[model samples]
Target: MQALRIAATGMDAQQKRVETVSNNIANMSTTAYDTRRAEFADLHYQQLRAPGAISSSTGLIAPAGIELGLGVRTSAISVNHTQGSLRQTGGDLDLAIEGRGWFEVTLPSGDPAYTRDGAFKKTGEGLIVNSEGYPLAGDITIPQDARSITINANGEVYAYFDGETEGQQVGALQTTIFVNEKGLEAMGGNMFRETQASGAPIPGEPGLDGRGAIRQGFLEESSVDVVAQIADLIEAQRGYELNSKVISAADQMLGSTTQLR
Candidate 1:
């Protein structure tokens, strides 16, 4: 019975791992999508030795009994933080983070958020925003008739209007860092919300205080490694299969025991 329970637990853990891998594959093309990896831990062990059944007195039988395991359970799911490669899109609004830092922005509801994806665009009001139309945190806005938009490595935006003497600074971007970014809770759309476990957000100007420089005309791709995810998927599948086989073997053993005279 204990073996059966343990095998069931193994199946459950593998099922969860398989689900995680499936999600990774499904989001392989999603920009800035982070892959999740699951972990498991063994349950508590039980002693089956009978009370007052020791051999010190009778010297007949030993108090030996197998220690049964309760089962296993999911321990954690760590988010990988490796930076993705920058893809040159040649779009003026397209941006990529060159190092460790997240572009701080507010959600459509004005709630503060952070994201590694930098595929930003301009709204009808000429305000710099992301694809989801969320305004950039710095309240940076540009003129409607601006021409020749340029974003420098230091997160500064320059634009020259049709009749302007020269390009002017129109956008000033900032990034934020956390003590533990992996602990930040994902809120979809490649955005993350601050959590107690993540610590406080440290806002800094781009290219300063360890924040990453903004690369204009480019976008960051997803950091997932296809080969690694595939390998993990294969291993999880095999583990599930082996657990199922163990359960089948245990059922057969039970049948044989029932047939004993």
Candidate 2:
């Protein structure tokens, strides 16, 4: 019966692992997406005999204790924050970070959200916003009469008007960094929310104070690797099958015991 229970836990753990792999594979083409990994921990152990207890026959202390692990449980699912390769999109609003940092956006509820996806668009009011219509922080706006726009690596925005040899400065963009980016909570849509574990957001201009430089006309790809995910899926499938076989073997043994007259 204990074997049956222990094997069940294994199956559950493998199921979680497979789900994680599935998610990663599904998001392979998602912009600025990060891969996730499932972590597991052993359950409580059943100690049949104490290690330091005196032997009944020889009156000597036991060297090793008998400890049987109950099962495995999912400890956490950690996100991999590795940088993804950048692709040139040739779009004016498309941006990507060369190193580290996040773009701050204001959610509909007036809460600030962070994201690595730079596929931004301009609203009818000339306010720069992401695909979800969330306006980028600092309220950078473009004028209607601007002929062309230019964004430099330093996060400076400039617009060129008609019959002018020089470009006028519109508004500047800022970047946000975190002490522990892995501690941020993923809110889907390539957005993340600040958490206590992630510490407070560090705001500064792009390419300054260790923040990444902004690359115009580019987008960051997802970090997921399809081949690796397929391999992990196969391994999880094998583990699940093995645990299921253990449950079947335990059931047969229990059936044989009950058949004894």
Per-residue C-alpha lDDT of model 1 across residues 92-159, encoded as one tens digit per residue: 88888898889888886778989988888888888888878888898888888887788888888898
Best by TM-score: 2
- What overall lDDT goes with each candidate model? 0.86, 0.95
Error of 2 at 204 (Å): 0.9
Displacement of residue 68 (Cα, Å) in model 1 is 3.6
Looking at model 1, the pairs that clash are: none
The TM-score, computed over Cα atoms with residue i paired to residue i, of candidate 1 is 0.90
Those runs of model 1 whose alpha carbons end farther than 4 Å from true positions after fitting are: 48-67, 163-165
TM-score of every candidate: 0.90, 0.97
Q: After best superposition, candidate 2 residue 218: deviation in angstroms?
A: 0.6
